[model samples]
Target: MDEQPETVPEPAGGLDRRAELSEFLRTRRARLKPEDVGLPDFGRHRRVPGLRREELAQLAGVSVAYYTRLEQGNGRNVSAEVLDSIARALRLTDAEHAHLMHLAKPKQHKKKQAVRTQQVRGPLRQLLDMMDGFPAYVSGRRSDILAWNRMAAAVFGDWSELPPQDRNWARLVFLRPEYRDLYVEWDQKASDMVSYLRMDAGCHPDDPRLSALVGELSVKSEEFRQLWATHDVKEKGYGVKRIRHPLVGEMTLNFESFRLPDDSEQTLITYHAEPGSPSAEALRLLASWGADATRAGTGASSR
Candidate 1:
């Protein structure tokens, strides 16, 4: 019989970093096949999926025992060079590499963090307002919608109508049916949200609120549970989104995310359409009508 996988109990208000590292590496390894890595495939029935412990160890120039220890969640003594070797053997992307490093060597938190509300700086809010036709918003840690402009409200519904806690992207995507209808590629958006949250979990595993949010979503949405189990992580930089609007029909918008230098936890996201395109024209119409148009179409109240 196959040995049962080891389970680590999560500490109150936090995730176990070692457990996270083990699961992440295991999933990464499971995605690969011997043929993909130039190894012989005899076409015999294999006990486990993907590369075995010995195979990965040989590829990484490490002993089977050492690799087994690492895979079993003992990475305290692992070196950077060994990590690099393992990462190369796993064929991890840049984002996945960073996430691996974070999981292996998570920042040590001395004490529990105080629950504090994230505030949007006045200048940043003013900057969003100044963007005019572009849909812009500020997102804080855990994908919280900290602040947004009129164009953003018009394009993505009036967030001001929701309670402060309900303004989060994760909640909006998973809990609200309207958002499922809003995005033309809803699955992609859902995957992106889970990836962003996974990245956040790697960085701040001790955040109680983040843990609670994950717990709530896992219980509430089966889709969220499946995606979260994949343990994917991504750094959101820029992407094109196609959304269907109630009033103006469908429009494709290019979005860019800029992390604040002073506080890396905060990011400014702006969306724009190609000049003179139909999507651009739709954006112009939405901008002219402002948030009022969104409220009228959705029956959402103003702030």
Candidate 2:
């Protein structure tokens, strides 16, 4: 008989990631008003915050037992139809819907297919290059900077200063010290990143890179660790960001993200301050510094 060697077991945190999500879902749902759901308060004494379990089950087109089991993390496979119904019951926005889908779906394992660093397409790169005045960059669903215009590199700060392998925006936001100083509203920005990333997890549930990235951030960043507990999610279509600069005080910039249908995995983000405003002037000044930095960083001639 051959003797078998004992193998060490992996560490278990004993924390239920699924239960955590369920509680958060229930809590968020309970916070909504009856009127919000087009239902009557009916001059009746209500005990809970939002709609009742029956009401939610009715709206979601699921049986009370099934919904209860789901909230308790008792289900094996959560179907798409069921998810859509629950999203509707919760009155979720597009972003929230995505987050729900991510939460319900199990992550699929990624095969070792000789993964290489991803980049933006040829035409998309040209599009960003043409926009000289605006801060523009192409980012993957995981917030990897596939490419950036000169101004984008300046405004967002260049990651090329680090090792070639460590270039993720989320990683930088959580792990890098410089990022905290870069954004004036670092807390808001971090929350937004978390929310948007949470939504993306649904869209690409099978991507191992996303799960690995999440795990890395969760372990490395104390701030990220704290925020991850909230279980909040949102679709970040457009938002105003207030940025404080070490050199130039404060500036408010509007951000817009456009999804590329063909790529599905990438989006283009642009930052614009108001025209004829102090922020515009500040943007110009920053652009000059950013241009210099980009030139030096990429070893490219001044444009």
Candidate 3:
């Protein structure tokens, strides 16, 4: 007698985890080639890009039909052993493997719908202002830039000048030309932002604002569309960024994303330069420039 696979509860809003899993597998498969995976080409013209289904199945020690079913989003009761095998076969990164686990078997956590508010509380704003040396900003769950310190504006440009809809960090990453020029590794930064947003969407699939944001970016940016389809997920955390500020020139800084204890859904991102480095000097200059901008009521000239 054939044993039935275990069933689990569906994610919030009945989000299509199967479809996400399928696309993720497909994208990961597409990125690999026969030689890359130590397989020999038999001198036959290939019809498709990346590794063939049978080849991947062989590597993962799964039957071709079963692998096909998984790719087709029809595989039920996929076990942790099988998922680990697939992750190893695909050579997924730690972050990528974690994302795969989430999509494949999402355990139900009490879904806390993000509080919708554009206004930052007075204390939060004051905290940001207090960090005069550090460029800091608080972003909502959907990556909306709710509030920023003056130094943040100086370092990352004046987000307040843009319309409310344009205040979103994710939107600026894709749509603003200056933003592309701001990062030394623009594609890497942009990809990470999109991945973070994808992670958020998986958690709160029913959020209409998130849907609208994703839909708008998909229509406007081909890069966003391609990356979104890849089902890559990332949590915003500590990292280093190489930035090309128009006013301060090129500098590298460490950035950390901390979830506000009071508002668990909001993130406070702060950038800091290493002490006694050229970047540190740049930060000082930026702070001075920010002070000047505040006094003048006009934005600082980056050039």
Top candidate when judged by lDDT against the true structure = 1
lDDT by residue (1-303, candidate 2, tens digit) is: 011111223222323447655865787678778888887778788888788888888888899988887887654677989988988888887777766666677555576233334555777778887887788877775676667777766665554454433556677677766667667878888988887676666555444666667777888887887777666777657888886654556778899989888876678889999999998987788677754645443221121
How high is the CA lDDT of each candidate model? 0.84, 0.69, 0.77
| Model 3 lowest lDDT segment of ten | 1-10
* lDDT tens digits by residue: candidate 3, 38-70: 999887988878998999999999999989988
Instruction: Compare candidates 2 and 3 on lDDT and give the better one.
Output: 3
Q: Candidate 3 deviates by what RMSD?
A: 8.9
Show model 2 residue runs off by greater than 4 Å.
1-24, 33-55, 58-61, 74-82, 102-117, 288-303
Q: State the local distance difference test value for candidate 3.
A: 0.77
Give TM per candidate: 0.92, 0.75, 0.77
Best by TM-score: 1
Query: What tens digits encode model 1's per-residue C-alpha lDDT throughout 1-303?
Result: 011111223336777777888999899999999998999999999988899889999999999999888888898889989999999999998889888888887766797666455767778888888899998898888898888888887888777777667778999899988888889999999999999999999998777778888999999999999999998999989999998888889999999999999888889999999999999999899888865676753323232
Evaluated at residue 80, the lDDT of candidate 2 is: 86
**Backbone clashes, each candidate:** 0, 1, 2
